[model samples]
Target: MFAKLPLIDYQPLKIIDIAQVYCTLTHPHFSNQIITDIDQEINIIANKSQITCQQSIPKHEEELKIIAVVKQLLTNLPKYSYPKLSLKFKRIISLPGKSDQAIAYFQTDLLTDSISTDLIGGKLNLTYNLNSCPLYFSLQSALIRQQDHRLLPALAFEGEFAYGNKDPREILQIINNWSEDWLTFKEIINQGFLG
Candidate 1:
């Protein structure tokens, strides 16, 4: 039998307090040294084996613009690391017909892709039915290269916490737990696929 993970105590926080976060990590081979200043909200880091871009306060429309900028930067590079891309966004949401007085938890596998004798990649959709509302979480990852659909390295995760809740302490705790689990899962993927 396996032991269950310990849950953290609830700490209330306003939705606005949680800044919108975006992260992208590519394979080492695709890493380059060209850095372009996009804006104050965006931060770019270029290393020998990877290029990472993080948006502090990301907007829906800005996603496309960011991707375009990344593509343009990639063009300047002479070589490509198998072309792996990962995008993640997190925000708060609201659900109707859900009571804030109930406690529930649900999760399911949304999709999966694998290779022989190994779990290559997949996605998991989760819902936390709380007393105030339901929080939705979507995580998607793959090891396939975007250019030719060949296997590479990639991962993404998005968590949407329900808004309009009277109390946020419980929700914050849930988010904390989910984030811890996500970190562990990411490490596994890093070792298995990106390593």
Candidate 2:
């Protein structure tokens, strides 16, 4: 014969523990590996879509969207100034090439090579000098919003909030309100840019 035992529950939970509980219970183990796998899959899908769109020849469906975002950012250029700002970019037409032909607005500063890697978007590695040039920061906002590309302008950039400065989100909000479209701008270039 066996005796019946009582089931008692004893646990400690904090005020901010509810969300954690929900996330853990709902998502389960799903370790970092799983998360990385899922993220990679989604990225692959998005890259495919972007490639398809890019390769669609002169079909300018999203042209206005890009142009509007760029112009909107350009409109607010006179507001702020960043002395260390430098600009460089390359188009990933089936793995960006290894050359300096695409360099824009500057002669000496060149994009010698580029690669597709897990670190950055098509890894646009470049070699240039850091002279005391008056490179504006607003362009980053424009570029970020223009391509709507994920990842910050710089590898070390952490969103728009850093070193107790103005919140990036707030600046973006101001831009969004002023732009013709409300909340349509999804990306903000130069996320880590600062004076």
Candidate 3:
């Protein structure tokens, strides 16, 4: 799904401070057994909206361990209905010329009856900092109304990478890697957000 989107490759960039990947599932029930089944090494947080497992960057060899945990969670989910899945990747890049930094936010959401109708899609907002003289840009897809009264099978990738003091190409490379990993993760579950 990400392949179809435009690639972000900007020049004169710097470092990435944060990288986050997340997904949402449609399970309304909670199971303690499923929680127990996860490896103790991963951090699992169960909330009203969803169960989230998060981990900081692991050693190169431990990547598979993280993937394994994600797969296990998906396998335990109920198969009766479609799940809401979302993947987010974020980084902070530094700019050499400016004392202040810029921020960019991007996101897309499917408009369903469950959501408010006033929401708009494809939103972009920019703000400037007078002290540091930096800019912040926010980009997002408007809420696309669903024709049918059901929740549209869709996935949204959102968030922004902060512009810091590292190489721009390298920051994009990291984003690309994370995006590819997300694609592989989706394939492992044999599910696509947009069916």
RMSD of each: 18.7, 25.4, 18.3
User: Which window of ten consecutive residues has the lowest lDDT sum in model 1?
Assistant: 100-109
Global lDDT of each candidate: 0.37, 0.20, 0.36
Error of 3 at 142 (Å): 24
User: Can you tell me which runs of candidate 3 are displaced by over 4 Å?
Assistant: 1-14, 17-23, 30-43, 57-64, 79-82, 96-98, 101-195
Per-residue lDDT of model 2, residues 1-195, tens digit only: 111111121111111100000001112222332211222211111111110001111233332232233234334432332111111121111102222211221121212234212222222222222232221212111112124553222111111111112233433443333222211111222112110
Off by over 4 Å in 2: 1-67, 82-86, 93-195
Candidates 1 and 2 compared: the better one by lDDT is 1
Sorted on lDDT, best first, the list reads 1, 3, 2
Evaluation by lDDT, superior candidate among 1 and 3: 1
Model 2 clashes, total count: 1
Position 192, candidate 1: lDDT: 30
Deviation in Å, model 1, residue 101 alpha carbon: 12
Global fold similarity of model 2 (TM-score)? 0.17
Candidate order by TM-score, highest to lowest?
A: 3, 1, 2
Tens digits of per-residue lDDT, candidate 1, 2-32, equal 1211122212311111222222233455345
Q: After superposition, how far is residue 129 of candidate 1 from its true place, in Å?
A: 21
Any residue pairs clashing in model 1, and if so which? Answer: 28-49, 29-81, 30-81, 93-163, 99-131, 100-131, 100-132, 101-131, 102-131, 143-152
Q: Model 3, 26-70: lDDT tens per residue?
A: 455555424432354556665444555555444353453544555
RMSD of 2: 25.4
